[model samples]
Target: MNLVTQLPVSGAAPKLLDFPAPTVSGLPTPALRGKPVPPAQRVYFYSPDEWEVFITEWASGLSYRQIKQLGGSGDRGVDVAAFKTDNGLEGAWDCFQAKHYNRSLNFSDAFPEMLKILHGVVAGFYCRPDRYVFVAPQGCGSTLDRLLSRPKELQKKFLEDLNKSSAATRHYPKQTLNSIREYAQSIDFSIFQSLQLSEMIETHRKTPYFAARFGTALPERTVVKETPVTPSPDEAVYVKKLLDVYNEQDPACCSDVDSLSVHTTYGKQFQRQRESFYSAEALRLYARDSVPDGTYELLQKDVYTGVIDTAEANHPSGLDRLRAVLTQSGQLDLSAHTLISVSTLEDRQGICHQLANADKLTWVDTNE
Candidate 1:
């Protein structure tokens, strides 16, 4: 009997089905997906504000959730700050000042920002940061880079530049240029550093939101198909072998082969096996679906190479072996569109045996 669930036309929630809908494993459905951002256009088109967002996201990896972006009016001197707390006492504090420039940043370009840091510290607007970074699309030029590497040389340059500037003399707490020089002399110019565009991009890639940044899908894995309700006699035999491998005792084996998953230990092992199976299956399926018929085997060999390289390291436990297999899965370069063409879990288990007999894999019993 077909049961149709009805809903309200407007201003009220619709009646949900008595039974929940089926869901796909390992797939996430976000409300908004990343848009396609071409590499060439990415850096060129992003504004200063967009750059701050990028920096904030990258910095979060280092300081985690402690990194904060100060965007509104009264930010004192800091643009972004990363604070660390240890033993209930304030630990390390770092600040990043983002400068978006089309051309390379020179000494003159950095001077103003340096003055703000000095003024903020002296005036007690904020405590001095352990590390102060100048972030820019085009990093400091050769002259500034050399000056930064030498503390004495940088300090000399700062004073020399400040003395010649009417802006420094006119502004500040009514102090002579010499007073400013005395204050600057006491400061540790070595705390200053620069982070360029390339470094930020590299850090960003390691983050979970990496695909979202580039508007690309995450690395694809094999799609799971719905198994038939009735299991063949051969299916039952393979299921028992799998149950034994997972060390499941008193498994209520049935025509529904997936029922073994109810046992706690078996469930965890099944997930790990499923993940490895999907990865290996993606490679095999990719080979079959290639433009030219015979190319699949070549691709399969490449996948085998990746798997062997990742999994060959001596692992003491089943958990370690499982991790190695999962790592290899992430390394596979299958597309989301093509990865759906995978074999059933039973078929993949057969392939694992094929690999074992070929000496490609040695499925040793290990404590998980």
Candidate 2:
């Protein structure tokens, strides 16, 4: 058997939680982390608006009629639908029925509910890693254990149980035991990266990365824990440096960037349709936008609130102050029309800092 192709044994996955993650952990701390959406479950629990937000973020369609078609009801089940469309392997969405209550999660009642959500997710295409997910703040009793212990047969049984009850459950010809196994393989494990507890416990689970990291050193016949090697000092140093450079370049979040262009931010408008930066009326929204061939990605909020309020209120001191900031932080680049904002011409230190940060920016999102 090809060792690399074989299923990984337990002990090989990245165990960041078990490793006493360094205080200087390059990754963002948990405090900066946002709340996770619920795992799989049936029944709508989120407000109509919250669900709308989730759908809009992940899926493009979110009209009231579309919501009804997507089967969003806030009666008592999951709150948000991250991806509910039934398109293809990539589009096969993981529907979540958020069960957000003031009390702790009841996993015992929720695990079975996850099985139900999976069936509701049925379509011809199989999304890699798994098409279904359960979203709950806290789940029913032993829900995690039950989910962890679920056997192939049980998942099939769960599917049958769901198909029998849901009239809305579209008929999937391959709703058999084999299809469940195939679907199981397609299950996306990306969900674990979000759930703290799921990530913690996954330390003990078997996966490909675990194998690649530790290689084939198995336990003695008598039995004992497998010892995984930690990164050597040299390896750790290289990894740290590489990560530092990588972080500054990746634009998904904070990149030490130079130039970027996005829709402009027109100031608040009385006309319903005139508020967007993309609109022609919003061209005067900023002095920078008036420059030739200028594209604005970020609009300092103070620019709008301060400038507009000053001009409308007929305040000279305000205009002078606003004009001063522009001379310094013009958001200038050679490709960009020379516009100046806050810094003084002699502010060598400020210019250096801006230039250093700008070197990393690529108008095209490098992070993505």
lDDT of each: 0.55, 0.30
* Candidate 2 ranges with C-alpha deviation above 4 Å: 1-71, 74-92, 102-108, 111-131, 153-301, 304-368
lDDT, candidate 2, 143-207, per-residue tens: 44444346554354444554453432333334432344354445542332112224322341232
Task: Report RMSD (Å) for each prediction in the order shown.
Answer: 19.4, 21.9
TM-score of 2: 0.30
Q: In model 1, how large is the Cα lDDT of residue 70?
A: 71
lDDT minimum window of 10 residues, candidate 2: 13-22
> Residue 82: error of model 1 in Å?
1.6
Clashes by residue pair, model 1: 287-296
Q: How many residue pairs clash in each candidate?
A: 1, 50
| lDDT for 146 (candidate 2) | 49
Angstrom error of the Cα, residue 7, model 1: value is 69
Model 2 gets an lDDT of 0.30
